[model samples]
Target: MKISEIVTILDGVLVAGKDQMDREISFGFASDLMSDVLTLETNDLVLLTGLCNIQSIRTAEMSDIPCIIFVRRKKVTPEMIELAEESEITLIECNYSMFKTVVTLAEHGIRPLF
Candidate 1:
């Protein structure tokens, strides 16, 4: 699904990379553990996590995740947003909890099984 469709589905806030809104995302990975992210392998992964920090951005960069969803009303800092921007990663924030975020994406046909 396109990132724009995701934003519309989740009503997520686009904190950065507005241009990426139209980019196509093939799948998603919901994880808060960086180690878990390091182990998983996928292209165009849209990561969902409540850990809103620079580490999350770094993890996403290393894992090549195309976009990130800050779950459960977690707020992403300006520095993290800048880091994502530098890496050309799309950052999205939403009030939905982690479970809701994953379910919503799955319902929208953005499952991780790709």
Candidate 2:
């Protein structure tokens, strides 16, 4: 699915990288642990987490993740947004819990990065 579609589905706010809305996402991985995030070796995946911080952006950069969804209504700070923008990673903030976010994405055909 496209990042644009994900945003619409989650009723999320685009925190940064609005230009990347057309990017395709085929999988998703949800975690608050940056260490776990670093273990991913997949592409076309979106990171879903409630850990709203600069480290999330850094982890996404290291893992080559193109998009991040901040769950549980967590907000991304200006610093996090700047870092994400620098990495050209799209950041989304949504009110859904991590579980709901993952389920919704899955129901919409986004496979899990298991």
Candidate 3:
């Protein structure tokens, strides 16, 4: 499914890259560790992190993650939103816990190993 489709599946808010919503997302990596992300296989990356801070967004950018989904209803700052906008990364906010979010996506055909 595409990022746009996932947004609908999860009832998430698109905070950035509205135009890129149609971009297909084959897989996602759910984590809060930036270093691990940097070292992992993350080409077609959709980041799911509970760290509701600018660093999360920055880490996504550094790892070339096309999407960032903030789990656990954590709200990101306006600055992070703007950064995501500038980076052209799709950002979504959802109230689901990280485990629930990951499981839900996996059950819906989005696997981390893709």
Clashes of 2: 0
lDDT tens readout by residue for model 2, 19-45: 999999999999999999898789679
Question: What's the true lDDT of residue 74 in model 1?
Answer: 92
Looking at model 2, residue 20 earns an lDDT score of 95
| Ten contiguous residues with the weakest lDDT in model 1 | 105-114
lDDT by residue (44-102, candidate 1, tens digit) is 77989998889999998898888999999999899998999999899999999899999
Q: Which stretches of candidate 3 lie over 4 Å from their true place?
A: none
Question: Which candidate has the highest TM-score of all?
Answer: 2
RMSD of 1: 1.2
Q: Summarize candidate 3's per-residue lDDT along 1-114 as a digit string, tens digits.
A: 899888887889887889898888888888888887778665686888888888888888877789999999988788998999998888899989999889889888897753
- Which residue pairs clash in candidate 3? none
Alpha-carbon runs more than 4 Å astray in model 2: none
What do the candidate models score in CA lDDT, each in turn?
Answer: 0.88, 0.93, 0.85
Clash pairs, candidate 2, are none
lDDT of 2: 0.93
For model 1, how many clashes? 0
Specify the poorest-scoring 10-residue window by lDDT in model 3.
Answer: 36-45
